[model samples]
Target: MKYDKKEPETMDADPMRLLVSAILAFTVMLFINGFVGSMGGFPAFVAFTLVFFRIRTRAGMGNGGMQQELSDRQITGRLLWKYAAGYLVLWGILRIAFLISRVTGWGNINGASAVEYVRQMWNTSLLEKWAYFFAGMIMFAFVLSLFPLAVIREKVRWIRYALVDGAVFALVCLGNNGVCRLKFEQKSSGGATCLIDHLLLCGRMRTWQEITCLLAMVVFILVIGAFVFSYASRQYAVKNIDGIPASAGEEESRRHRMIRKIVTVGCSIAAIVIVVVIVLLMPKDTAGDYTKVAEFLTEDTRMGPMEYGDVVYVSVNEEADLEKNGIAQGYLAERGERCDSRFYQLAIANLLYTDPTGKTNLVQTAGTDGGTYAPVASVETDKTWETDDVFLLWDEDWALESAYSHEPTGYVACPADLIQGLRMQFPDVTYRTADFSDYDAYFTLRGYQNMEQALEEDPVDGDWVGCILVKDNKFYFGSYENQITGICLQQLRKVLGGNAK
Candidate 1:
């Protein structure tokens, strides 16, 4: 009896298909790394390993180019140990590299040490920081590529893997960095909290630019998802097909099934914990009550009667928006005669006051009344002045524009001699002077086309004003509706004496 000759096994997988699979896997891993932040490496490693196994099985490694026929327990145990060992080894290598760079300035180290370099990078532009991170990722990916390449039975060229890895690196770096930078620049403020809020789209989109950027980001994510799915499907024909078991009589062991069940439960618990932690860590805005502070300052006339000869400059804390509480409501009540209709009151509350509550009756009303308010520009000032005051008073709306412009165009209340004297005290500060006439064109350009349409429904004596006053050497800062003008003037008179005109 003669034995039939067995045909030699041949590698039939396409190189291009393998390359595409590798690229898609790496891209997805990078996304996981980015979304979960700096400590995202563990999850990314596990995800990458899982995807690698699927790709390997699809390429016909375990079942002689047909399916994965290995025992479930054997496969799971082997992959876990292999991946964990590799991850720890790579982590050690990176730590060693960090130490070496710190000691010898060998790599991208820019400061006295690696820690200092990281801190400096944090202060740099968002794009620059992401670029640095992606550079490191590329190096890590090169090492990782070898594992997947070895698992495949096909003798594919190394250059193909390298080319695919390079393409993946570029795509992830550009796509993530570009989108993050766009969102970051559109933010009104910058901080860790702001960055997180922007990423999650939790922050309010206040302008057209922010809205457009958000929409673009949504489109970008969808496009990327489509490409990843298309490429992955073409490269790995796993869909609509079942894998053959190791033997005709074989079944998954009870212990192996239990292990998988444990893993599923563990992952679910971990995900819930992460969500709870993130919610707890989120920042909350607190509306400061400055009414007591204001009253305390006003009652302490112990500084003695302010003299016109003694410069009395005043400034309010510009960072906190005026809270819409008793102080705000009281101020509004005094100006009730000027704000004849509810519409004007709503506009004043929404536009002129900064309520940290985020929602107020006035804001809700304004939203329904078809009225819009101009966004206020945040102005920074020196906080060292002793006489800083916080009260609400409305002056011409153009006063803010004039002050920010830094042009000497408006008639400031303090005498020129007094203003010059105060200027000498703070020689480093650049002050802008503006008169009523200087604000005429500014008002028009700012959409105050019809003063009646822009302000109160009924004509008012003046628009609401919030300002910092510099008289002689003192600064008084306040915010209020039109009625606070007289009270503010009274305080000014006490400080200016006969000089207040």
Candidate 2:
């Protein structure tokens, strides 16, 4: 079609296409990065940024529907290959590892905790169904990748582009396959991809409030979409109109430039907010992921599982049953808000059948082979266990022995009676004095370095210990050998129905 001689002809901007593209990218990001947390997540984030630029440029340069045609393939190539399939494998590995760990790792010896882990891991049926649906879709997509092979000449390019995009995604997102893994050392792994992942990966879905990441993502889309809209429309105006006065064309170009500046500033602000939100909400480490450690602990290693160990992890996520699992949301107890040991310790205690409803006051005692050789204060908090929270000292004298180190009051509520009672309950499990080494050994086995190293670098936060290693019927004070966190305390507290004081 031709334009009239007097006025400049304006072409309509494809707002729908831009909007649709953003939504598609957002959904792919959530599916690939948000819930599943694969390495592809950051690349997917980068891809979304590129998608906006491509859509606008193509729309401005095209006549009719050409913009949508070629670009849509890129979407298929980018989303399905870069983000979807990558997360599919990672997410499946996590789920399968969880199941495998349950049945094989701890289940082989600690039958009691095995049941508890399985029951707690699959706590919500609805969430499990959603997870299952996600898994099924991943499988479907994987199969779809093969369907093109059946009719080789027809859709082969689609698969080819997908693979090509995937390779690009890996190289760009991982700095050519150089990931820092799940271990954090308070030092940047020193690469561009590491920084991007640090700034962009969406937070895992733990509580409902983590939806902030989604809001951040949407804002990102809208900001980019606005720029695309204005640019496309202005380009359309320049191209479709002919025989217009030079001044009018100059005026249009000038206005477009101004709009571009405004949009650029707006986009910059939005990008900053997105980065801030991402950093604030990004899953810091892979500690919540225990599937690797759990599955591998069953195998013998060079340094007895600690050598060449890869314990980096993703969150075993859920939004339900936060209370039933003794999340201790509304309960009055030790404020585990700041202490790493306290958080895991209290969480386990809250789940205990005995201490689930009890007021707890037991001390963490150790004689030697632990750390600094000094004992922490006795447990004088409102936390409990099935039988006890954490047990270390076994001898009555050691349990009763006065300790000079502790918090605030400097006096510990020595649980001599509690130790004797616990000892009487399980007389066969030889107990040893415990310390940070137990937790240290645990983290070390999973490639965490050690307890002190973790505490120094990452501090107390999410998923301190992934899977509790089961000893072959030996109890180190209140924990076990090669134990770190008190997650193994579940073995004794499996029958808690009352207070342990």
- Supply candidate 2's per-residue lDDT for 12: 32
TM-score per model over all chains: 0.25, 0.25
True-vs-predicted CA distance for residue 379, candidate 2, Å:
28
For all candidates in order, the CA lDDT equals 0.34, 0.31
Clashes of each: 27, 12
Query: Cα lDDT for residue 491, model 2?
Result: 32
Per-residue lDDT of 1-501 in model 1, one digit per residue for the tens?
111234322233446555655565565454434332332354444444554554454334432233445443343334434543565465556566655666577655333666655654355544334333433443344334334342323233223443454445444433444455565443322222322222332223446755565465456545543444343333232211222222325687999978866765565555445534544653442111111111111211111101111122122212232332412322111111223222122222222232446552221011111121222111123222222222112333433343576532222233323323333433333223222112211111111223343334222212112234443433333211111233344454453353334
Worst 10 residues of 2 by lDDT: 365-374
lDDT computed for candidate 1: 0.34
RMSD score of candidate 2 (Å): 19.0
Off by over 4 Å in 2: 1-63, 66-185, 188-217, 236-501
